[model samples]
Target: MRLIAPFLLLAALPAFAADPTPEITRPAGTPQANGVVHTLRQIPEACARIEGAFTGQAAEPYRFAVVRTSQNCQPRARFVDFDKAKPSEAAGWKFNDLIRVPSAACPSQQAVVRVWRKPVDVGQERDGQGQSRIYLDDAMKTAAAGKLPAIPMYAAAMSVEGKACP
Candidate 1:
């Protein structure tokens, strides 16, 4: 039968494959850095809203990281959005916050600077190569912001919001 129909279409092509990209597991005092030093501000009591570091989302399903002081803000250099953020405390190494952006749209500068961290990797969910391996756990449920796919498993990112307030 034509060589068993090409071995049954290559054994059913592994059941159609193509489904395995959902990860973000790395939270437990997450601080192992060859780089991690942050500073930036523009809170001005909220309305200014340009904090610095981490963005939003929390509970369990992780994704956190931010470093866009400028470049017009838009993926200018990249660090994407790590699946949408979650680990702030599912057990241990909780991170995710700061790097605010509002000031009407994008106009940073309340003063305070110190950026330099360039090694990232979280657990097991990489995409497109930019590098993302998220793996942190604990919350069980709560992190629900865009769901997932923003892509940004952390390995370095820490912030402090003080200077500008002076």
Candidate 2:
């Protein structure tokens, strides 16, 4: 009876277990790298991704740019809103507040720069040891192919002055 009770308890435990977190699947054409790509809050209607490269330099370690997921799909939102008033540092990178940048698609609306850093090394040691090297190499290939290196960080859009969509 003792052994049977233990088995029954174990079986019931799973029924009461908490639900697992949903897995976020990366969109097609997401840049592959050794380091982890932190998930960003996304605009439900808009599709976007973080595009940039690892310079592998001290003066300018990381360069990030937000772009649309597809050229044909024009989202109403222009810029990403991190909901931050000031820059925050994490994992050797400085996540900046919303900074407007010129947008070719929407001339009146400015795009936002969610992150930027000029850290020396950007703590390569912390990036999965030797992963940064692999990223640099992959970045070069992406650039050569006439495509900017990109990750799966989808930016949450912020509507600016003007009609949201053309």
Candidate 3:
């Protein structure tokens, strides 16, 4: 009876612990059929899709410049610098690999690209009225899967800052 009681207590302890949230996978820089390299950006209230072209070699330590392709997008989130440094587990964001993107201005049709993501905070996930706020991580996954357009308009929007191709 003593051994059984201890096992039951251990099983119940898991219920009191918070469920672990899934981590978002790093985004890739693969371009879509329309020649647009789609990626995600963390906005104030939601995750946004940003289109851009790679500007250098398709290797580590690349740079991605934001381009203005859509009318419905956030304008402030611009520029991503991907470095070769190791990603820090303690930091909210980490460095990811470089990818090839289509670029017109660049000598080569392809350009180098890298991605960085910021960790989502628990408090920011909910609003004062207890309503859910951001869906950045989910949008990021969708973008990586090459299905950014399928996401609901409210959950994600288009974002652009400058012209990466021109």
Candidate 4:
């Protein structure tokens, strides 16, 4: 009876397997995105609307790239926190890879989900500050909550394995 009981328990147990490699998917007409996470900032005003909030750079130890000051919109060089090859000196806070979801911009609803990981080099976990998940859906909600200028929350959103996350 003991042997049979063990067999039954094993049969009833859920399979514990490692997460499979994510299959990246881009919707039709979605352009190839560079590492750049662009922002629609007021040309002469903000270098970036809220760069520290996104990408991977901390508010400190950061620089601006503005070659043509007269242009309305242009690409700028943003900083990164980690490389998996070259780690950042300021490692207190870091951004996980941008995960594209779906948004209202496209006919198909896809948005992106981004998160902050404080203390990148620390073992296991990080500090609570700047350590919450950021979702494009939430950004949409924020934008919708008020009336005025509506800046885009993300450059793009994608789907993988038929799921709603990047």
Candidate 2 residue lDDT tens string, 86-105: 22344333432333333334
> Looking at candidate 2, what is the lDDT of residue 82?
50
What's the lDDT for all of these models? Answer: 0.31, 0.41, 0.40, 0.32
Clash count per candidate: 24, 0, 1, 9
Which pairs clash in the backbone of model 2?
none
TM-score per candidate, chains pooled: 0.16, 0.25, 0.28, 0.20
Give residue 106's lDDT in candidate 4 (0 to 100).
28
**Per-candidate RMSD, Å:** 22.7, 20.9, 18.6, 18.5
In what order do the candidates fall by TM-score, top score first?
3, 2, 4, 1
lDDT of 1 at 4: 100
Clashing pairs in 4: 92-119, 100-158, 101-110, 101-111, 101-112, 102-110, 102-111, 103-110, 103-111
Report the number of the highest-TM-score candidate: 3
lDDT (Cα, tens digit) per residue for candidate 1, span 7-96: 999997885552122233222222212122233332221122222332221221122234344444443122323224323333232233
Candidate 2: C-alpha lDDT: 0.41
Candidate 3 global lDDT: 0.40
Worst 10 residues of 4 by lDDT: 152-161
